[model samples]
Target: MPPSRTSAAAQSANFSTISVTFLGTASAQPSSTRNHSSLALCFGGRGDTWLFDCGEATQQRVQKSDVKMGKIRKIFITHTHGDHIFGIAPLLAGCLNGAGGMIDGMVDSRMEPADPKELTTLEIYGPLGTRAFIRSALRLTHTRLDGRYVVHELRFPRDPPGGDYTTLPPHRCELPGKNLLQTPMDDVQWGKGIWNDVYADDLVTVSAAPIEHSVACVGYVVNEQPVPQKMDPSHYLPHIKRNKAPIAYLSRLQRGENITLDDGTELLGVPKRAGRKLVILGDTYDPSPIMPLAVGADLLIHEATNAYLPGIDPATNNDDTEEVVQARTTSRGHSTPQMAGRFARLIGARQLVLNHFSARYRGDDDVNEEAKTVMDAIKGLAEKEFCGEVVCARDFMTLHVSR
Candidate 1:
């Protein structure tokens, strides 16, 4: 559990900051040092928690961390890959059976029946077939998540000639000029629109764009709404002390409204701080289409599955040739470290966090020497190629994001 909040911490916790906890970071397969892909995004301090790509045993990982499973309000699945979504069933089951207490004969319950009002509704967004997947899992496992969770299946607009693109409500950004929609040949329904606005609320808005992958996949960008300006209490304290102004005036001033003093002088409210933006990509070989959405993002979390570091020769290490590595990664729809760097640079991300490493990069010992070496190479290449802070993500690592 996290430490009790101090007065200062409590003051700062009012949605002024966002933090991301890496629950898992391995790719395709789990390693001794890493699990599959899972990320927990906490916004506005403890306001809301969102999970991206809950891989197998992700709930167990959450149990091992300081994150509160009951606080997870949303889950975004990049795709239906086992490595990315196998944990959804168990996690949903756990959410429905909060505190692990028996609920009307349901096993895995530990506490009293959870109050419906206190239970956070879990909204899951994912690519096509996601609804069926969740339903089938619940049925097979006999897990009852009836009103506890909702699944949203996203589909691309059909091809342009065959179908037209229509603008959706709550536009977040300018549409990408280039044609990013996949064609019929891709084996899935193609959409005319380059991006889709999946979720939105007063606090944050989320959008998704298709990316090049072996199967239908999409990347998500989350942008927080600009915060309201903070009121400068010092400026009004003098007036309150001198004239005993009504305390109600303080509420008006905090809402960015001008307050009229007894002397007819007007006082303006201070503007609140700006919000932050974050982008997280699914398993993809090409990230070009999503660059528009990722532009000016404060943080970009992308996969670095292949070890084809630039300026390094794979043959010297007695491993597979560079050409072989590149071909395999490309064919498998995975990105090399250099590719991740290039995308971060192209999108002008402020910070780049590389994860989703292939299991082969797992170190011989617990020290993770091989992974560190690869991470160093990636950081070096990205420093030269991009002008952003580069970081290698590890399981259970937490990143604090602020403006």
Candidate 2:
């Protein structure tokens, strides 16, 4: 059976800054230290959540973390690999159950004042095949959910191999006896791209763009929602406090408004420019074209699947006839920590976070240190390439991408 997938959503709140939480970081499979690749974006003081790449064990991961599935309103799946997907069905099922159950449990047993029935809805976006996959999974499980959500997927005529596109020499072709001299028709064909306007808020918007990978993949960008020009806060603060509703006052502050009370009290501290931006990349070796999409982002989360490991013979390459297929594994769309850092610097990312580590060096001993050594090396590759901070990720680690 094909694995399940869950996508990510974007949100904002008058109460807090927007943030994303990494739920899993392993790829293709789960390791003791990592699950698969998944992230949750929390927005809206309303607690709306967006999920990205729900791999297996995602439900458990969210359970262990502060992520509340009931808050997840959307999901974004990058690609359909077992380790990258597999968690969707169970999570959706669980979320649906939890939504109704939370209300039932609250009314019957707890003394909470708020009703749970008004919880947020959930939607999932992915490549073209997502709808079919989700339909099948839900059908097979004989389950129906009360909460409404949609899965968007990218479609391709043929399944592509894994990894990003590269300009391999004809001699390096995976095909036997094929040289670069061959006609363009002989070259591999890639899937077209897809762009979806997934989320919008009073002050920010989020969209997805198709990216090069073994198959059709996507990169996402979250930009601050467009807002009215800065208001003279000198005009708005005093009356807001007189309203006696801090939440209302804060909402007006975010919307860039100055309030006038009967006494003409003024508000201060409204944002001068737009909000911050963030870009999260999936597993692609050469994500060059998409760099501009990530430009000026406050934080960029890119995959660095290999870190500090000498070469390994994945033994999966068809080009083993060449004496050095071991070196070629890294060449085939897999990224090392150094490469992740190099790309981050190249894109002028404000912050570079390395994740999606290969299983080789994920051992208990010095995994974090080993990953850092490789990323730090990228600094030497491109002196002054990135002025941003570089971070090596750990499971359940959270970081705030501020404006």
The candidate maximizing lDDT is 1
TM-score of each: 0.76, 0.67
Candidate 1, residue 34: how far the Cα is off, in Å:
1.2
After superposing candidate 2, which stretches have Cα over 4 Å from the reference? 1-15, 98-120, 154-196, 226-271, 308-331, 363-385
Supply every candidate's count of residue pairs whose N, Cα or C atoms clash at under 3 angstroms: 10, 32
> Which candidate number would show the highest TM-score if scored against the true structure?
1
TM-score, candidate 1, is 0.76
lDDT, candidate 2, at 308: 34
**For residues 53-127, could you state the per-residue lDDT of candidate 1 as single tens digits?**
999989999999978887887898898899999998888877666222223344432222366454445777777
Off by over 4 Å in 1: 1-13, 98-120, 145-147, 159-197, 229-231, 234-245, 259-266, 309-324, 363-370
lDDT by residue for model 2 over 159-256, one digit each (tens)?
A: 34231132222110011210101011221342233243455545456666666567667777877654345456445555555666464665567555
Measured with C-alpha atoms, the lDDT of residue 398 in candidate 1 is: 90
- How far residue 286's Cα lies from its native spot in candidate 1, in Å, is 2.0
In terms of lDDT, model 2 sits at 0.60
